[model samples]
Target: MNPEAWVALALSLKVAAWATAINLLLGTAMGFALARWRFPGRELLDALLTLPMVLPPTVLGYYLLVLLGKRGWLGGWLHEQLGITLIFSWQGAVVAASVVAFPLVLKSARAAFENVDPQLERAARVLGLSEAAVFMRVSLPMAWRGILAGVLLAFARALGEFGATLMVAGSIPGQTQTLSIAVYEAVQAGQDASANTLVLITSLSCIAVLLSARWLAPQRSAA
Candidate 1:
């Protein structure tokens, strides 16, 4: 309703967009790999990738802080080499959201790839198409709708990411406070009107995204 609320909502959209883009790129690759490959430890790797979906957001945030805090091993290296600091920053929120949203995309993309007919793949290979060509022209086309459904699913998850985003990004108003955080603070401060506005926006955004996902992959809707 106010300028501050507008800023948080805008920031949330920006962060969620970036996070969803990153998830789509990496999740599609990993999901396709897992679906198409057979190797030792594959099951273990899949479980590890999917762990975020089941973990509490606070727990995930704590791990991110441990891994990316200024004095942390990876964080220290990043700061020293690249001058990149994720802690208490919007970039950190993107990372947090991406982590939690990853499994959704991966689950859908993997299922899409798995559902592709093996006969079609063999046919493409026999037609002299390279592996990449077959995937791009055949496999990807066939599975694209499902992959898109997965992408929207991830985007929706990223949009409302709160606990992990708050821990790493610190809810710094215009800088890092997302819609979820805005609603949270509004409630805590007894600004019921503001909280209700934020909640309504969030509810609509989620519904729009989920409906888009369903429309994208009607045949494989996650009923």
Candidate 2:
């Protein structure tokens, strides 16, 4: 394998790993909240959460670029306050992947949280357990299999993310180039061997993620 290929692979792994980690945390929280709480705009929030999944990736990318570009509102504020810039960087790729993968995590986790028996939680509360404690001890453990499935799904989505990542991160080799970007670049440059190699790796990773998710899922009782 070419050294550049290795670099691309490493960077891709870094971005995907970080994206998955952040999404797992945020998605789980959002899923729990959406499942357990009622508030104004809750329905709107749910719709928006799933919107990215339905929207064209290019459109999503364009909007994200506008929102997070250097001169854009949040981007400018972040640049000034934190001295950090997301545009055309690996971090930007991670953000894009996270955005695209979030819905998968949120949907699975929300279903899992909803399926959890509220009676268990109530009993824990009656036993003097705080809400947080009840959630940590009873709810989370009971839903662990589902949460794991969601995390795996999100990780797979992150690994395969392309359009938004390309638009925001710009396929800069050694900086923002990921496996999907590398594959595209290789094909564009007529490097079939490299493209094939990347494709194989990505396909295998996706399969692994899917299989792992299935294996990790809780076995259903035979009816």
Candidate 3:
């Protein structure tokens, strides 16, 4: 691969890593809450969270663009007050990837958390462990492997994100261009070699992530 391809690959990894790192904690919390707690509008929240799973990537991207574009209220306030512009930037790509990938990790974590015995938590509480202590020492350790598998899956999903990324990040080569975007542009420009190179790398990366997930959580493996 050339320097540009290498850059795209690097950026893709960076974006995926950032997205996964953030969502790991956030998604785990969301999953735990959804799985263990019942409150008003819980089902509504679940449906909203799962929207990305069923919605078209472009549709999600469009929503994000509208929500984060300069003219949008949140986006306008962010830019005006905080000077953080999301549209057409790498940050925008990360945001897009994170949103698209969130469902995977969230659903996986929810299932993992559900599989844990509630009695274990009660036992920890009875031992005088604070909620935080129990979570860190008991709950987290027991559920970590399953959670890790979900994170890997989310990373892989983020790595391959295209439509939403393009809508928000606008595929600027060596800047916001990720492997998936690079492949799209290469094919569009009839650069078969470039496209093939990116495809090969992406395929290998996805396979590696999936294998790692299986290794970490073999019991959760589908196949």
lDDT of 3 at 192: 99
- Model 2 lDDT per residue over 124-200, tens place: 99999999999999998788777888888888888889999999999888999999989999999999999999898
Q: For candidate 3, lDDT tens digit of each residue in 113-148?
A: 888888999999999999999878887777776688
List the lowest-lDDT window of 10 residues for candidate 2: 214-223
For all candidates in order, the CA lDDT equals: 0.92, 0.89, 0.90
Question: Could you give the candidate ranking by lDDT, starting with the highest?
Answer: 1, 3, 2
Candidate 3: the clashing residue pairs are none
Candidate 3, residue 200: CA error in Å? Answer: 0.6
Q: What TM-score, over all chains together, does every model reach?
A: 0.95, 0.94, 0.94
lDDT of each residue in 1-223, candidate 1, tens digit only: 7898789878989999999999999999999999999999998999999999999999999999999998999998999999999999999999999999999999999999999998999999999999999999999988887789889989999999999999989978889999999999999999999999999999998998888766656665454
Is 2 or 3 the stronger prediction by lDDT?
3
Q: What value does the lDDT take at residue 162 in candidate 2? A: 92
Pairing residues by index, what is the TM-score of model 3? 0.94
